[model samples]
Target: MDKIGFIGLGIMGRPMAKNLIKAGYAVVVCDVNQQAVEELRACGAESAATPAETAEKAGTFIVTMLPNSPQVREVTAGENGLLKGIRAGQIVVDMSSISPIASRELDALLREKGAEMLDAPVSGGQEKAEQGTLAIMVGGSAAAFEKARPILEKMGATVTLVGESGAGQITKLVNQMIVGINISAVAEGMAFAKKAGVEPRRVFEAIRKGLAGSQCLEDKAPRMFEGRYDPGFRINLHIKDLWNVLETSRAVSCSVPLSGQVIEMMIALANEGHETKDHGSLGLYYEKLNNVALKEIQK
Candidate 1:
């Protein structure tokens, strides 16, 4: 089997690397967090001291599951970046949610060195990542996608090659836009139900089978009702995702009226200090606006 380099061992990255290991790949992993690297090393993955080391270990293909574009740049550029040691015919597949423009720029840079790049951001959150059931949106050359398909298949249930360079990030931005708007809508709906003396849970039960239902409503409404705001996906991350959408929309001269409004509301919520909370905590914003708490309604 071919060796693979995996970088970023956060919530999603850890499990993703694990699945690759379980699939019997020769996986070499790296992260800024030594502890995260140690944990993966314990799971039969070889440890690389740096991103460049990981790239050198797996010359043909490397996978990055980083946080944002800046982190992506840091890991792929400069003396310490993966590109420093990467050779031609090698491929770097970024599963990080980043701007399409940034991905395109990186692709150009990597191509100059005889390597290829794929913008292949994923959806389905940590739970799906842990279960190896993410939906991966890929954008790159057809041959590059084919080379990376088997490895990507181990981590995602749905892996699609959307189009050429940067299209995956574009698709992921679309995914985040809908997710941001949908979760906020779910939050407001739950809040309205509580304020109207209806049990938020029962309200979800009623709409869950109707046209008003959505994956966001089912996944987030219960957490909103229970006031469980643990960070499965942090609000700050979603805020960044929304900012990407807004910025990309502006660059393309696209008018996303509803998405723009949701981005403003998310910024307001984050500014009010909900950035560390789970995005489900957005329900609390509506609660504050209405001066009615779900806990009070439950009583």
Candidate 2:
């Protein structure tokens, strides 16, 4: 088993790293949150003070599950960086949902240093992360993908290598697009039903078994009716993803009117202080506009 160095021990990263350990790998972890570091250590993982330190000790391969492209770049571009400790044959696999263009750039950088890199982003929110059943989309050379397959399997139920560098991030963007659009439609439908004097719950049940049924509906519909805004995935992060969608669309000369509209609504929710709430809380916008609550929000 390869010694694994995992950086970023947040909601998703901690669970993923734990599963690697559970698979009988020697896993070392590092994070800015000392509490998170200690928690993983308590599970039999070693802790490191910095990315460089973790890379040095666990140089077989490193997995970064950070929040964004900027943080991923920051972790690899300096003295206290992953690349500093990466040897000629080491692999770098980033599981962050970030820009594909940036992923490609990082791939080139790692290759120049005689190492390999994979842009392997995941779907299935926090719940699935804890369950170790995420669907991972990988983009890298065939050899790199093959090398990372066993490691990826420990953290994800389905892992597919789609194409060359950046494909995984592009796939993740498509996922966010579909997810954002579905949540928005669900919110609007619930709001319209409530204001039209039909019970929102009943309306959900009726359509959910029809052509409108989806994983989004099954998972987020109840949360909508209950007005639960906890962060399974935050609205703020969705908004950031929409920004990426718009940028990617512009580059491809594709017009996505619906995604554009949803982004504005998400921005509206963010402006109203629901940015940190679950993306399902998108219903809050419609509730506010219609002067009705989908369900009584628990205080």
RMSD of each: 2.0, 2.2
For candidate 2, write residues 43-68 as lDDT tens digits. Answer: 99998888878878885689999998
Off-target runs (Cα >4 Å) in candidate 2 are 296-299
Sum up the clashes in candidate 1: 0
Question: Which residue pairs show collisions in model 1?
Answer: none
When summed lDDT is taken over every stretch of 10 residues in candidate 1, the lowest stretch is: 290-299
TM-score, candidate 1, is 0.92
Model 1, which residues run further than 4 Å from truth? 193-202, 295-299
lDDT of each: 0.88, 0.88
Measured against the true structure, the TM-scores of the candidates, in listed sequence, are: 0.92, 0.93
Clashes of each: 0, 0
